[model samples]
Target: MKKKLLALLLLFFIGNFLAPPVGHADQWGVITIPPGKPIKIGMGTMLTGDYASMGIDIKHGAEMAIEKKGKILGHRVILQAEDDGCAGPPSVAIAEKMCNDPLVVGLIGYMCSGGSKPASDIHNKYKVVMISASSTALELTARGIPIFFRTCWNDKIQARRAAAFALSRKWTKVVVLHDKSDYGQSLAEDFAENIRQKGGKILAMEGLTRGDKDFTPVLTKIKPLRPQLIYFGGMAAEGVLVARQMKRVGLRKTHFMSDDGCYTEKDFIQAGGKATNGCYVTYAKEPDPEWVKEFESKYGPRQTFSPQAYDAATILMMAVERVAKKQADGTLIIGKKALRDAIADTKYNGITGEIAFDPYGDRSGSVVVVYKVVEEEGKRFFKQMAF
Candidate 1:
């Protein structure tokens, strides 16, 4: 009888241990695995085609962080990078593939704001956490998606800075030029509104297509306004062309200003050459000496959003590790919902600075840095200013 009672007790203990507690194990058993492989996060950005420089830098930054942290966020991490061609359908396709991939619980990239916005919608639909290293459209954050976030400041802050910079200089008459793309138009409208609110008058507003070469018509109309300043909201290609054309037409008195596109890339200098002098613009952030040292070791002397990109990947991975730690047997289970929750709650220091996303997936207290041009020996170098 004693031996039988002992055997029954052992059977009861084994049954209790094997049977998982109620709803969690049964409901989630199908999707669950025994902490299979390392957590995999998909990164989507423009690794090719135009604007590939920014994309390359973004990838380098993230890759550097992953290399330092090791794959396994305490377990292992896997990063799959996809190039979206920085356009419409290609970007959508990339996002769709990442969303469907079981291993890719989170995503980081699609630097273009237009691409980020559309891709983010798909990410949210599939409950995949996604973050941007460069997209700064205010509307991207205005909608309040729980899983969407950005490492850079939004267009609103940039527009406000531009308005304040122009207004403070007593430049009452201003001309606005944009590329007619979403980024350009959005920032132009915001800058216009802020300038008006701050008592600066907009003398004229014009736009050009992305690849349009001839700006004679737009410049001719804008010149008549005799504006003190010209705010061009477009990429470097058009911006440089506009500056050179304006110089040709003797609109030298009007100082030019642009947003991130002009500052972040080297195109404005390369395109306009000597003509890019005296132009002012805004940059995302200044590089830290220590971080630059590290970046130089990995990537050469190319300036890009390496720090922010690194942070975005690191934050997502950290969250995945957190989820893995809380598993039943310390198994690393990197599912979509778990990864999303981990990314959503990240509060850590990034390569640029402290990173803590607001409810709308926007970083709080992120300021836009303004820059001025100083040309030497036919080369352009931007001077950072605190405004």
Candidate 2:
């Protein structure tokens, strides 16, 4: 009798445990926050090292939006930042953390394309929605993930614009360099295609690993190529180092160009100093007339994509208010499906531009802007070019 009773007990426990977790939507990833509780929104971006300022500026932009919006469905909204250092492993860790937390309804960023590619898979596994602040890898949209969206423009049109800019400058002989990451490689390839289309010659194509401080070896090789333009498809940190080394390697007279990755003026100016002078960069857009006085009053200055980050956070907050359901006990419930739908259907005009998403989660409209690093009034900054 005792043996039979123990077997029956084992079967009972197994049946209950395997019953498929029967619960209301509140018990799922979307927690029903009671009144006075804060709704958590997660951030995945670099917060340390040479790239820390970009992510920190993005966080401040989101804070500015939250401050303006007040709250979400009567619950205070809070940002939970898990610095990923713009690398894959740390980004995955933050994605896991957000997935495990029931209150994290949506996320703001995975700033780097390499990080976003892998981290996006984890978000998909758990059905969490993420809108990126500064990731522009074309392959990300190629994946067709509904939950992934980006406020920044991708490399497609930007590459063409950059190619046109090079041709217009009569710098037909160009050397293309990339960091070998998803963002850098794709941008290089896309830009190369356009460069060829515009009848420009690619003198030499080279690849460098990210976080590589020494570019002298590569610089020595490319210097002899005598390319009219040397375009690096990488971020500001590496680009700055390369610009400084180009002078060291006797490539000082060559025109150096880069894409959005090298658009952070402050970092480039600080690191590259006079090396960045006459350097040309292309970006989707910059934050101007974007409540700059108010933003700088609180957060110092606008760096890189801070305005777009603000818009990304504001868009998420708006979606939260749109999809949140009020319960009888005064708690708010944000269902995963409803929030995703709200984001998919977004069409709000943001400070950066129109905040809309297409079927592939790409913005409906984007324009590439070019900048030239110049010194004016004893200050070095990127000056917007008309063409």
Candidate 3:
């Protein structure tokens, strides 16, 4: 009898160890937050690298939104920010770390599309919702990941609009360039497709490494193509280099245009100095003046996508408030699927404009604006141009 009992005890221990941990969660993926525990939101962004400015701006925006909301259902809301490195490998690691933490309810970012794409698979497996403020690659949503949502406009919309704007200006002969990143290459391809559909001539399509500074060779080759415009699909880090080297390669007469990746004044216009003058960039429409004033008062000089980040955080918190159930002992029980559904049904007016997500988790009614880099009072700034 003693030997039989020992065998039974061993079997029980093995079963318990092998089974999935559902101590604070239900079979339906409900996360239980004990009394006095704060609701944690994970933020994975580029905190260290060339794109740090954009990520820092996103962090500040989310911080402001959380501070204004104060608490959710008598529980303090906390943001756990992690540096995603704006690349694939770091993003996957961050996603794994955040998803494994039981306290982490949702996420706010994976700033670069290259990072977001791979990290998204991990988030979906854990049923963790992530809303991006800047990853604009169209394929990010095309995969039908229910947990992935973005406040940024799709690259297809921006590319089409840019092509139309270029055609309107009679800049038919153009060279398309990308930084070989998921975000940059996709945007360039879409823009090139749109240009072809609109009867514009694509002189040549080229790809470059992200961190490389020398683009004179490519520019020199393209200069002979006599393209009227060079549309670059990359961030300010490489955009500034390409713009500066164009002059050295004797492409001074070629017009330079880029996407929201190069929209910042400090990085693109200011960094490139005279090279960025008259350069055209595509970005989402500006937010409310009153809200901008309030944000600038605290954060000082907003970078791209801050407003979108604010709205993404605001929407997530609001969804959490709507779905979280408080138990008799003051514990909070939140169903992961319920929270995602609540966010999908969101229809709130945000500082950036009306907020609504489509079936594919893309923001509805997103407007892309074209701006020109110009010098005013000896300082370079982006001026909104009437398109």
Give all candidates' CA lDDT scores: 0.77, 0.85, 0.92
Pairs that collide in candidate 1 are 71-76, 71-77, 72-75, 72-76, 72-77
Clashing pairs in 2: none
lDDT of 3 by residue, 204-264 (tens): 9999998898999899888889999999999999999998999888898889999999988
Q: In model 3, which regions exceed 4 Å deviation? A: 1-28
lDDT (10s digit) by residue, model 1, range 96-162:
9988876675788877877887888888787777888888778989887777888888899999998
Candidate 1, poorest ten consecutive residues by summed lDDT: 24-33
Winning candidate number (lDDT): 3
Each prediction's RMSD over C-alphas, in Å, is 8.4, 3.7, 3.7
Specify the poorest-scoring 10-residue window by lDDT in model 3.
19-28
Please give the lDDT score for candidate 2.
0.85
Give Cα distance to truth, residue 285, candidate 2, Å.
Answer: 2.9
Where model 1 places Cα greater than 4 Å from the true spot, the runs are: 1-38, 73-76, 325-331, 376-379
Candidate 2's TM-score reads: 0.91
Q: Against the true structure, what is each candidate's TM-score?
A: 0.87, 0.91, 0.93
